[model samples]
Target chain A: MAVAEIKIELKKGVADPEGQNTKKALELLGFEGLRSVRSMKCFQVDIGLEGDEALKACQDMCRRLLANPVIQSYSVELK
Target chain B: MAVAEIKIELKKGVADPEGQNTKKALELLGFEGLRSVRSMKCFQVDIGLEGDEALKACQDMCRRLLANPVIQSYSVELK
Candidate 1:
């Protein structure tokens, strides 16, 4: 089996409330010198396929359902 | 400034409904691949600090807020 790791993040200029809240929380906890924070999603998929086939499958998955192309971008790493 | 990317994942044995649903969705979409999927969260934090300070701060953030110690595990990468 092979593992495909996918990382998805919001596009630039998009507002991320969770990240904003986390920054606020950090500030409340006395952590300083933070310029910004952004949040994203990750996925680890175990597939029976191998090599390039695995990556191709994952890329299709990302485009079809894992990420919203309008506001998010994603990358897949197969191992 | 430095960027600290934190990837948070559910600890082994914890149920991941989202990943399960995603697998099902992929199958429904006629993508043939066998095995399992797991989901995680990632945070890209921009900090003004440098070197060890940034990594240490991010680790502290993970311990205190970014991850639930009982059910999730996280890793921080500084760039």
Candidate 2:
């Protein structure tokens, strides 16, 4: 078995309200020196199969549903 | 300046409906060999301040808002 870790984040130039809000909140909470904050989603998948087949399936999944290629970028790590 | 990456995930034994649904979605989409799926949130904060002060502030944020200590676990990475 293998585990595929997928990280999805907004592409550069895209505005992230959640990240902005968090930064504001941090400042309000007295946390200083914050330049910016960005947020992303991560998925950890456990695959019953290993090797190339699993990797391909995961890549397909990412392309089809896990990420929006137009607005987000993703990276996959298999272990 | 520094960048702080925070990863938050559900604690062991906690139920994750989103993950389960995603796993089901992958199977329905014909991606085989999926045993399970788990999801988490990742935050990337850019800090103008470096060293221990920034780290301490981040830790406090995690404890107070970024994560629910009772149900989730979080890790911080500084770069």
True interface contacts retained by model 2: 0.93
Return the number of clashes found in candidate 2.
Answer: 0
Residue B28 error, candidate 1, Å: 1.3
Model 1: CA > 4 A from native? none
| lDDT of each residue in B1-79, candidate 2, tens digit only | 8788889999999999999999999889887767789999999988786889778878898998789999999988899
CA displacement after TM-score superposition, residue B24 of candidate 2 (Å): 0.2
lDDT digits (tens) for residues A1-79 of candidate 2: 8898889999999999999998888888878778899999999999886878778777888899999999999988889
**lDDT of the structure predicted as candidate 1:** 0.90
Docking tier of model 2: it is: medium
Candidate with top lDDT is 1
How much is A43 displaced in model 2, in angstroms?
Answer: 0.3
Model 2 scores a C-alpha lDDT of 0.89
lDDT (Cα, tens digit) per residue for candidate 1, span A2-79: 899999999989999999999999999999988898989999999789999888888988999889999999999887
